[model samples]
Target: MLSKSISSLAKRVSSGLTPLRSNPEFWLAGTIPWLKTEQLGEKFIYSTTEKISKIALKKTSIKICRPNTLTIAMYGEGKTRGNVSIIKSEMATNQACCNIELDPELADFEYVYYFLKTQYNELRSLSSGVRKNLNSEDIKNFVIRLPQELKDQRKVAAVLSALDAKIDCNNRINAELEAMAKALYDYWFVQFEFPDANGKPYKSSGGKMVYNDMLGREIPQGWVVGALSDWIAKDKTGDWGKDMAEGNYTLSVDCIRGTDINGLNGKGAVAAPTRFILEKNKGKILAPFDLVIEISGGSPTQSTGRLALMTSESIKRFSRPVICSNFCKAISLKNSPYAFNFAYLWKSAYENKVLFGWEGKTSGIKNLLFEAFTTKYVVCMPSQHLAQGFFDFVCPIEDMKQKRLKENDELALLRDWLLPLLMNGQVTVA
Candidate 1:
């Protein structure tokens, strides 16, 4: 039952700094992964969104924390503060991170990480006064309680780590599967290699090609080139329903915002807030094959047209009818049966930075030029049969990915439910 401050258990507590961006030598041609507060929250961080040069590391206060070094966010917008993660490889962080190196003699590294995991809310509340920020002093002085025996700590950690390891494995498998699906799409659609009547890859087996003035390139016979708008059936802006049920606001829905799109696509956690709306707005409910695109809120490095493909499985993941936030639009393709083709088209456009050219700004927030993008951007539509073939092949891959996601969700639930009980000695590994 005895507890000690983190200062007693940690060998060192420190933070890193961002080097001067004005120096090209500091940022350009870098290989070292540099993390910011927004990158925290994952259990094991293997990579980062941004990296720094060795010159920056030497010239600045940044130091590469060893593997397993626990980093916590000190301050950020929204719920970015109090987020925590353990770097799986050598990495440097910004000033907003509170990095703690545990003393092997006084504490087990995994044990301490799990203990802090249960204190997320407490850590968030540590910030006080007008300037809300947690400093190194607060992290070092934070108290922790664990079994005195180091072996017992390891046992507890082993139990929790097993679940996390499984989840991590599933995520890796899912990533690989997604890559395969993308490759299949590229080969069949982009390369015009769908199977011909004889079951051979179309383009590779001397398939016919025709040149079109609109595309300024050769495409397979029967394929049509047209603007992005020709493929779109409907595009409607979303509504942010009332926060609470009252008057005509009787229907309850899970509101998906621009920030939540990637989460639905397995990139991160879905954090949509529930809202109450009028029953008459039921027509806005999202269904399978509907694509949601973010129209606003992009950063300098990112674009505003991030999308989410709605599948039957995706809809099933939500307990109630889902609605997009006002910052997004729900788009339905004109070709109902070939919806997957449009989804892949949008994805390819997004990955190629095509959305960057279609951005307009209002009040400093970047918004997608939805009308111009959908009305002017050109695309090549493959035959219905080829499109359907690609869809059939990718459906199983996506379904399997969804299954793994569901499993991870359940495993996380079990781990969270057992964490407090295990930490307090109410339950033992064996």
Candidate 2:
């Protein structure tokens, strides 16, 4: 049940103010508009790559919304699907944009955010336009059955917010873990800071250290770096490719993207079918313990060089002959001594330093050529034994992070289910 005071506030907002036509620049560009997308940050925004210019802002109308307000992306572009976000920042807008502002006193802001998120599909269905947009009238007329009291809204929002907070925390932790791993990899491999033959720094040795103009740093003693091709195996065929095409196999991106392979029980794990598959033209895919990488589309542009390990099950599933996509596939290794983790570390270093050339066409489809990655240079050989040792140390930490992600995913499912029900008064808060 909701408190009477909250219900009164809802009534005042619902019937008090008249909807007015306004320019977006007034909201997006003005002193402070209640609702704006920029506050959510790039991660949650659709097409984080797309930027809105100040000149473009001159065209749209901005609806005045309040702080902690709720707004929906009425546009139905592929990027706009399921795009429900809470406005934590202010903006001045121009004419041409349509947005609705909710009274925060009547509705809990977080609750409204979750409420709209749950109704995203419905909203999509109702939208109509060449670009699929929702008008302010449509939002004003949309019915949301809430408890009569504000207390109920708070209670409901609290529950969902807790779950979301946890998910956010988990994501942050995972990011930190990845950063830590990459830093350690760079320290030992690039800086060569590991203990030397006499427990001294590699840099202090009598070996020649010349300052490289490109890096503006001193080179290691007797150390020479080359391209990635020098280290990886050249072979591309295997039994694993066959199983993946037959729908009996899959791949995990956990090592690269930081997502986990769910529902795996034992040492023999199956790949999640979402991204991994064997292509007909490519024969005999990657095997177990094979190193694979995302060859395209990531930060630092050219070097979106993230790597992951192929599970044993993925290898068996694709055991049949088939070719993998150029964007993602196994790394060819000269020797089995180096584990996938070492390759992942090395790839990170290469990515950090390499300049990703402009690869996207004006057509909007960005293409990362495999040839570009193959030809791009990096150090090929380091002591294989040392690389393997690094992998052995980091594998446990990766496993733990994977488990936390899985748990957070399950909790998210629960929050999604509860949101709409509570908002619609189907589920009451005590």
Candidate 3:
């Protein structure tokens, strides 16, 4: 194996790829987009809405870095620095992002991407400055070891990329399935157009409607307006010790953060982080169809009271029971059917500000006024038969999403497991 300084091996390496500092005044807004530290870790970033137009690009020393270049975050806080990604297309970047366009004949860009990914901690350690910034020299002087043959580099990259491709494909499938489910929810509940007698669209077909004083709208006759407590069997805020206790390995509470909640649904959650615990608290253990609500942690733009449904796939992924942190509250529904219809209802509530209406902010942390919101906010309760039907229709879709998410988790595991082996020459491709 031979080692080479990244700068010596690469045809181009840049820390300040664009004039972000000197020309901040010219970067008001424009047609051409640029990336920030937040968008750097993904394999491909398609849009950076915060951008400067082509006209603005001409006014400053900024230039569009070409496609296939690797970009790294040189400065940021809390896992922002040292993260890497590839710009699959031509784009401009801010000062915090260092763009490296490699010489194809000398190195494979994908190979370099993976190599840099493995060196995130090392890169962070090399960072200097009051804020621990990774400068142009830091990136240039970095050393990488690899086989002399360029084919070998491509081979290693190909192996990793194949796994990534599979993971990406799985995520796409899950997103599509979720979208389909959401569309169905909107069509049925939001529109009040669920199938009526003789299988006709209810609202459009002139199904009887009565005004509900609480909801301030006309709902299907015989349906009731009720609070969330009607459907909730048991609910409690989670509990955790000062440190994660050690006995047997179990799931991590990180899986249920506020960011994981998108209205009533959760995304990008599969396996839990590895944490050891003495025993599972039976009350805290999560079951399929349960709801985990983010009761704390909020930003000015995003409030508390986000909800995520616990799926069967998640329950099966961990050997021990799944649990949330003190920041979250877990609620078990009276029946499984409520999981489908209620999730959408809660989503509507979130959008309409019903859930966040009672939030309280203190010390920069937002607390969900759970009892206040639950008691005051009303839900459109479908009849028993319609709720059952909605659950039957949406269950399969959620199942499909869960299956795809599980597959992605497995694929990611396979890729991470193989990365070091392939990087160290233990596993080779001809």
For all candidates in order, the CA lDDT equals 0.87, 0.49, 0.76
> Where does candidate 1 have its weakest 10-residue lDDT segment?
334-343
Residues 1-430, candidate 2: write the lDDT tens digits: 4323222333222111111334343334333333233233112322221223343334434233444544455443354533555544444322223334556656665665666676667766767777666665565555565565667778888888888788778767867876787787766666766556676655545535666554456766555455556566664522222222246335421222211121231111233333344334333445555665544445433444445555443333332332334445455667665664345645555556543552444245344444555556444345656666666666665665666655665676688688777776787767
Give the per-residue lDDT of model 1 (tens digit) for 320-387. 78999999999888776677788888888999999999999998989999999989988898888778
User: Which of 1 and 2 is ahead in TM-score?
Assistant: 1
C-alpha lDDT of residue 195 in model 1: 85
lDDT tens readout by residue for model 3, 79-194: 88998988876778888888888888878889888888888899999987688888878888898877788999988999899988987887787778778888878888888888
Cα RMSD (angstroms) for every candidate in the order listed: 2.6, 8.3, 3.7
**Candidate 1: how many backbone clashes?**
0
Candidate No. with top TM-score: 1
Q: Which of candidates 2 and 3 is the stronger one according to lDDT?
A: 3
Better TM-score candidate (2, 3): 3
lDDT of 2 at 320: 38
- The prediction achieving the highest lDDT against the true structure is 1
- Quote the lDDT for 279 in model 3: 46
